[model samples]
Target: MYARKPVIVLLGLAVCGGLGCAQPPACREGQVATPVSAQRHPVAGHHLRAHAHNDYEHERPLFDALDHRFYSVEADIFLNGGKLAVSHRNLPWDSKRSLEELYLEPLQARVDATGSVHGDGVPFTLWIDLKEGGREIVDTLHAVLEKYPMLTRVDGDEVLPGPVTVVLTGDDKAKRDLVTRHSQRRAVRDSNDYSPEDPPADSAWGYYALRWGDYLDASSTGQLDASQRARLACIIENAHAQGRKVRFFDAPDHPDAWRVALEFGVDFLGTDDLRSLDTFLDGAP
Candidate 1:
C-alpha cells in the first residue's frame, strides 16, 4: 500500500503506516537542519504538535511514541483489584502491564536518569483515558502521580512546570469530581466538547477534543472543500480565543487531513500512524 512516493531530501524515511513501507525509496542525504540540530536532544527535528493515539497498542508502547517525539501520548486504563491496568477494552486483566508499569514508572525512571522524558527535557502531555472504576481510577491515578512530583506537579489551579502533565479523560462525572471535589490535585481534567456543560474555554483545564469530520469534510471527501475549511478555521479560532488548545480526534488518518490540520493551526495531531505523521512533519515546512 506504500509503494508510491520516494523519501524526500533531509527526511530519513517516507513512512506509510505503523508498520512502515518497504525500503524502495532511499533515505535523503544529510540530516534535517533544524535549530535543535546543534543541541543533544534525540528527537532533534521532531515537531511537538504530533499526538500518539492509543499509544499503548504499539509494539514498544511509550518508547515507540517517544521515539517519534510526539508531544502527547494516550492510554486507556481500568481499575482492577485496586490497581490501574492499561488496556483498551475490559478483558482478562494483566497485572504486569498496569498503568504504573507501562507509563508512570517508565516516565519517572527516564526523568530521573536523563532529566528528560523525550531526550530534550521539554514538558509533554500524558493523556490517560479512564475506562472504568470512575472515582477509584481517578484516586488511584492521583496517588501514583504524586510520587513523581518533580515530573508531574499539582498546585491548586496551576500544575507548574514539570516534565509531564497528566490529563484525565472518560466518565465526565468522575473527571469533574477530581477537579471540583479535590479542590487541589496534581492532575488535570479533559474538557467536553464546547457547549453549555463544558467550562468556558478560558476555564477549560486541559484541552478541547472534537470530531475532525465535524469541522472538516476532508477526511472522507479526500480534501476539504472551501466551506469545510472555513468551518475548521472558525472552530479552531473560537477555541484559541478562549485560551483553549484544540484537538480533532476520530479524524481521518490520511495525509490530506493532516495538511488541513496544520493549515488550521491545530494544537494536536492525533494519529495511530506515528511513522507517517513523523515523516510528514519531518518533510513539512
Candidate 2:
C-alpha cells in the first residue's frame, strides 16, 4: 500500500460558534497611540570628590592630587606676624612657605593655565584650615578670595558664588563666632569627636568633620563603638537635613573607615593617599 498523506486546512473566523474575538482599538486619523511608559536614558553615577588634606606639606606639593583629579584641596594656614604661611605645625623654619607662594599663587596660575578647577571642568574646593588667631588672617583670606570668584562658601542656606571653598579651622572660638556673626566664611566641627552642643548658632556655620575614632578597626571587623557610631550617624543625618555636608579626617589608613564613610554617604573623605583611596573607591578587588 502507498503511504498516506496528511492535509492541513486554514480557517479565518471572525466569530466562533459561541464566542467572538476582540479587536484592538483603531487609531483616529493622524493620531498616535499613547505609550504606557516613556523611554528614559541612564544617568551617570556621582563622581567621587576627593580632597588632599594639607597638600602643601607633601614632597611634590599640589601636583600629585591635582594630576590625579582630586575635587578638593586643603592647606593649613597660620597667620604669622604679617603674612599667611602654610604649615601643618607652627615652626619658624617652615614659615618660608607662604599662602601665596606655596598655594594661592601656584593655584591661581594653574587655574589660569588650564582654565579648569583641579584640572577639571567643574570648580574644585580649596579648604583653608586656619591655624592662626588674629583677625588679619581672616581679612587676608577675604581679600585673597576676592581675586578668585570661584571659591566655595559655607552659608547656612545662602548660596554664595565662588569656585574655591575656604574653610577656617582652629580652636579660636571667639574669632570663629565673630566670623560667623559677620562674614560668609565656613567653619569646621568635629563630628565623631565633638560634643553635641558644638554646632554654631546659624547652622550654616556648622560643617562637621569626622575624626580618627569615627571608624571601625581592621582587627575589630569594621565595628565602631556603639555610641561613637550612633553619634556619627546622627551628625551625618542632622547635617544633611540642615543643608550641610560632613567631611572626615584623621581616619584610619585602611579600607574599613573608608567603607564606613561610603556606607554612611559622607560628603567628603580626606585622605593622605589619594591614589590608594581612589583605587579603593573604584571597587578594586
Best model per TM-score = 1
Clash pairs, candidate 1, are none
- Where does model 2 exceed 4 Å of error? 1-47, 93-96, 113-115, 153-158, 174-178, 181-206, 214-231
Predicted candidate 2 versus true structure: per-residue lDDT over 1-285, tens digit per residue: 111122221242112223233211112233332222111112212224566877776776777777656766788876666677778877674444877777667677776777655445566566667765656666776666556544555465565644455555554553365455544553323323343334443433545555543222123324354434544565555456555566767665566666666656667667788777677755622
Cα TM-score per model: 0.78, 0.67
What does the lDDT read for residue 56 in candidate 2?
A: 78
Q: In candidate 2, which residue pairs get closer than 3 Å at backbone N, Cα or C atoms, i.e. clash?
A: 150-162, 150-163, 150-164, 151-162, 151-163, 151-164, 152-164, 152-165, 156-204
What lDDT score belongs to each candidate, Candidate 1 first?
0.67, 0.54
Q: Return the top candidate by lDDT.
A: 1
**Which parts of model 1 have CA positions greater than 4 angstroms off?**
1-46, 195-204, 219-222
Quality of model 2 by C-alpha lDDT: 0.54
Candidate 2 local Cα displacement, residue 185, angstroms: 6.3
User: Which lDDT tens digits does candidate 1 get at residues 1-285?
Assistant: 112232222343334344444222211133121111111225544367788999999999899998887878999987878878888887677876788888888888878887778667777888888776466776787777777764555566555668887777766777777666665566776664553223353222757766553333443523665544545655565556556777777777878777777766777788999999999888765
